[model samples]
Target chain A: MPKRYVSIWFRYLATDLHSLCQPQLKSIPFVLRSPSHGRMLITSSNAIAESKGVCQGMVLADARAIIPELQVLDDRPDLKEKLLTKLAEWCICFSPIVAIDLPDGLLLDASGCTHLWGGDQNYVNDIGKKLHARGYDAKVVIADTIGVAWGTARFNRKYQVVSTNDHLSILQTLPPEALRLENETVERLHKLGLHKIQQIIKAPRASLRRRFGQDIITKLNRAIGTEIETIVPIMPVEPYQERLPCIEPIATRVGIEIVLEELLKTLCGRLTNEQLGLRTSILKCYRIDGKIEQVDIVTSRPSHNIKHLFQLFELKLQNIDPGLGIELFLLEAPRVEDHLPSQEKMWEGSVGLEDVRLAELLDRLGNKIGTQSIHRYLPDEHYWPERSVKLANSLQEKPIISWRVDEPRPVQLLHTPEPIEVTAPIPDYPPMLFIYKGKEHRIVHADGPERIEQEWWLQQGQHRDYYRVEDEEGNRYWLFRLGHYHDKSYKWFLHGFFA
Target chain B: MVVSKADIFKGLQTDLLRLQGLKSVNNCELNNFLGPIASAFPNHSFPLGVIHELISHRQEEVAATSGFVTVLLSMIMGASGTSIWISASRNVFPIALKAFGVDPDRFIFIDLKKEKDVVWAMDEALKCGAVSAVVGEIGEIDFKTSRRLQLGVEHSGVTGFIVRKASRNIGTIASVSRWKISSLPSEKSDRLPGIGFPKWKVELSKIRNGKPGTWDVKWFDGKFFPTHVPIDTLVASDQWHKKKTG
Candidate 1:
């Protein structure tokens, strides 16, 4: 039972970039160049350019002289590396272990992943198809070992799949460079009249190690099944959880609170030292009667304040019942963030914006009303009413763009613009009367249609013609015509209410 | 500073009032509630460290009740300390409170889904010594719940306000004072713009062994002005208008 490893080589990365970013250059010959000692050298070339006598390491002037219509681009190895890393991350969907091979390759330890996609053939085929759909021409090979997979992906023309029996036969045809060796090592092997891996297969091991040193034999052993390969995985984030065990079951709520306060004291110390704050925490009270009661609290921002955290916990404590007694308590911080220390002390210790009192208020409010419901909005640079306001991430995040106070915005804006029936004269005039939610309001005072065109690049939709109108009862409303008056899809909508 | 023969009894009365939690402002504030609203009470001032209940029997009257409470809350809250406002619905806009010259951030607004939690949270907030004041917008509060909150405020020396909607049972609860507030049409103005200064007809429905009467008050700028318009005068003015037309 041999393990299966999948290897993907971005053989034509430069051309694939051209196809992904600028699809118009897909059929043309593309070449990437880098400036070397004041002279441009070709870093990579597409199949079309290679077929037309263009090669990497060639002088740009000479390559251009051979194919005058070749598209030359600056070498973007950073972009290529980022693409490879992203592709490796994407491969985690198929296998839990995926490692990046720098500059243009990825290796997925597809030990158990192949059977999930039917078989080893389909597993490699599905990945290759997905990459191709995303404008990448990938060479995928699934073999018994990583070295065999790498050799097959680069050297084999059609059959890049290699099993245990076929791996040796495949290695016989591929060059020594297919084993991923240094240029000097491959050159020395070539000078010894051994260009293919099969030529060195029957060589004496002791003489090979003594003459060429250990590197060549090591490479040989790695290519064969003699040496083992391992991959390092991306580490997952560890949850911040602390557990406390009691000697005896405690029944009093005050007893449980005392334990909680002690636990929080220790946790806050660690969090502050690490400059981290908990956004959500859960206090699990395991009672001796086999009952588990948990109270969770969320903060508006990342907070590690012990007093504020205790007050928020105190609000939800009534929901917790001690019952017979409490045996154990566990406090878990599910969401943590890097929190920069706030300005708690103002001038001469005067209360400032980030006061402890304010934090307690926000935390207490966040517990009663959901944290999601508490929102502080700032103006955004958008003419669209829906996109005009953006929510602030924290209380201290000041708005760079000022609110457009010149235009009177409604005090209460509906989460969504509601459709309403309107009765008005001809095109684009303010509605004389409107019916919203089956209630009719006769408009008395009206303003003009302040037409706002749609941002077509962001979304293709109708332009809104907004009108501020006051009803007979002196209630003001913000109304808009969904699309252009000439368009057949035009409709009326009530957007918000004025104070 | 001398203790006269008659001044001894007057000193004894002042001391009695002070013992019943009557705190007098050092300076005269004719513009605020300390001038007129305070004198309308049995202690010759609004009693401190007690839960005050305000009833608004209609949807429109809730505004007047909140507006009237905002005036008292600003003074009781002082320039320091945080306030806990436990409400079931987020009907009172924070911006509207700002119009009353109050910083909305100074208040902790607890929006509970259940009415019982509002009372419980308010009671807990009242008991917390650090909190300066607590406001609970609840529906029906029984004597048991009211007495508990009353005891909490008494122990903590904090003030409490229970704002009930129109449909409350208003039977009897252990409260310092109970008032029914209704909004009145503001006076027509030629200077100020937007909505006029909030005017309310405050009726003292119940006060614990205290004077119960009605008063007309209006909030303008940052002060409360007592308008001298009683129920009899209003009816007399209507009769005079009919006679003049006839």
Candidate 2:
């Protein structure tokens, strides 16, 4: 016993398109026929047509002569292909793996899916009811082989299940035309009294091969599920789905929020089931008329938490203008990934609620003033005293640990070093009383000579001699003068104030 | 600028009320210094609720002033929260402040656009009441503006430090505690085999209710202990002075 290959063929006639295109054909006696075959291939009513002696492959002119009111229309291949694509999309409801069968069919590997719709018979009935409600006529057939299913769908019946052993007995009753053989082979078999598939199977293989070639017997054997036929379905495409089809178009902020909650619930549930989290979620609302309104939010980390995720969107919801009313709402996580939960005790302890609030405030401010307007200072890891900080935005992700400096620093640092016209004797001497802010104060007492050597590696290095000096009022200041040269002009800077 | 005898009595009363743990402008200040600086500076200690101006005419001035402020703040670094440094003009060198054990980890530097912005940010930081101190470098100051800031610090109770960089001379009218800092030649011999520690002279331009003059000081081995305040010794018998006092 050879291993079997089961192929289930799902055909959608696309009656919707047929009805739209052939609207005038309603209540009319119309027959779709092959131009070359000259027959009533598909008649609206065979009862009426049969009373007048009209049958398949009857000459159209003869059929028209028999029934003068007969209407013959040409087939549109483009329309049929478009309908097949839609049929493929509908089949995706059963499984993510559904591929289009060119012209008018879909090939689904419904092996594991039969139990989902409650067994094969119920699944077929359910699909049939759905299609019928949607104004489509659908047919499904399951067999051990692709060839048998193919032969069964067109040659068997509207509903079929050709089991392995019963395939031959069932196929034997089918006419030679049902084998889907080429015209030459069928004509050759017609001369041999092998009009029925059973008679063709009964004929001696050697004689059949001699007369009609091995392909006829081989095709016959494969069609009856004897020799296995494998089908390679077109690979399924990745889906980008986000749906919020509202029952009623919403127009107010409260209503929009309500709809948003429901949409987020459904979308988050789907993401959770798939074990995925969205990094970027875009909500596109289609207005009742035609225009589309969209809002997008990005999370610092991939997240699936419904409330936390909704909070981010709510902040942005204030900007959404609910113009007219939204008929369809789509929440799409265009970028998603598998979300793994990570505990954050370190950040929770180190960062205060004020820090989070400040970050949020900065984000809102940036949105209003433009993201480029807001800035934050980040410490630069360098030996240079003044050039140890860089500016960054609040939204930009950075390690919080780097924000802390490694060494002791000042309580107050000046914005700029003011040039003081000092009358100090030497390069290393602290300034006596230099004119500052245009007032003269005699240097009655002084302390310091903390020398900071130049960082020789950089071109902009400065040698500074810092001091802690007091004025007549007993005020203390942390000041420094540069050491660029022997008699370099002393630039006075108040770095910080003493307690 | 002149505090009357009645005002001194009032200040004493205020201090007494504050000592009783009453939350008032006078109560917010820390305990006075344990040494000579206690008499030299106003309020026995550096007042907390006041904007002290450290005016230096030259860049070398920051080192002189930073040395003193660093020594003063070394005791307060371990406390929670941070002291903010707002500098828009790139005057304060962070590493220079770091060398004095001011705990850069607890210091946050904010750079603003304009002088007015720096002042505005300082005012906001003062109101937040979380930071220990707020410091900024300003080039210009009027008497009225300084008075306004002094009132602000008094209300918020956080120390405010304004480093006013003067052009040619020390501006006497604007600051509560004004100092003139100048670099001094290292006291250690140049003939020494290695580079010696740097020394400086800090001129006390204004000391509220105390004498004002220059104090000779040396910052050696990264520490700033007063060097000129001589430890008087007994000439004949080293214990004679203590015996006399006893």
Per-candidate Cα lDDT values, in order, are 0.75, 0.59
Which segments of model 2 are wrong by more than 4 Å? Answer: A1-241, A268-279, A301-311, A334-381, A390-410, A414-420, A436-483, A486-499, B1-246
For B90-194, candidate 1 gives per-residue lDDT tens digits of 455443455655555566566678887777678767876666678889888898989899888877777899988866456788888898877554544444333
Backbone clashes in candidate 1 total: 1
**TM-score (chain A only) for the predictions, listed in order:** 0.55, 0.45
Candidate 2 chain A: worst 10 consecutive residues by lDDT? Answer: A349-358
Q: Is model 2 an incorrect, acceptable, medium or high docking prediction?
A: incorrect
Per-residue lDDT of candidate 2, residues B207-228 (tens digit):
6544676665655333443545
**Candidate closest to the true structure, highest TM-score:** 1
Candidate 1 lDDT over A94-209, as tens digits, reads: 78888888778888888877788898788888999998988788999998888888988988877756877887888778898887888887899899999788888788999888
DockQ of model 2 vs. true complex: 0.07
lDDT of 2 by residue, A172-214 (tens): 7777876667899888878878767888777788988898877
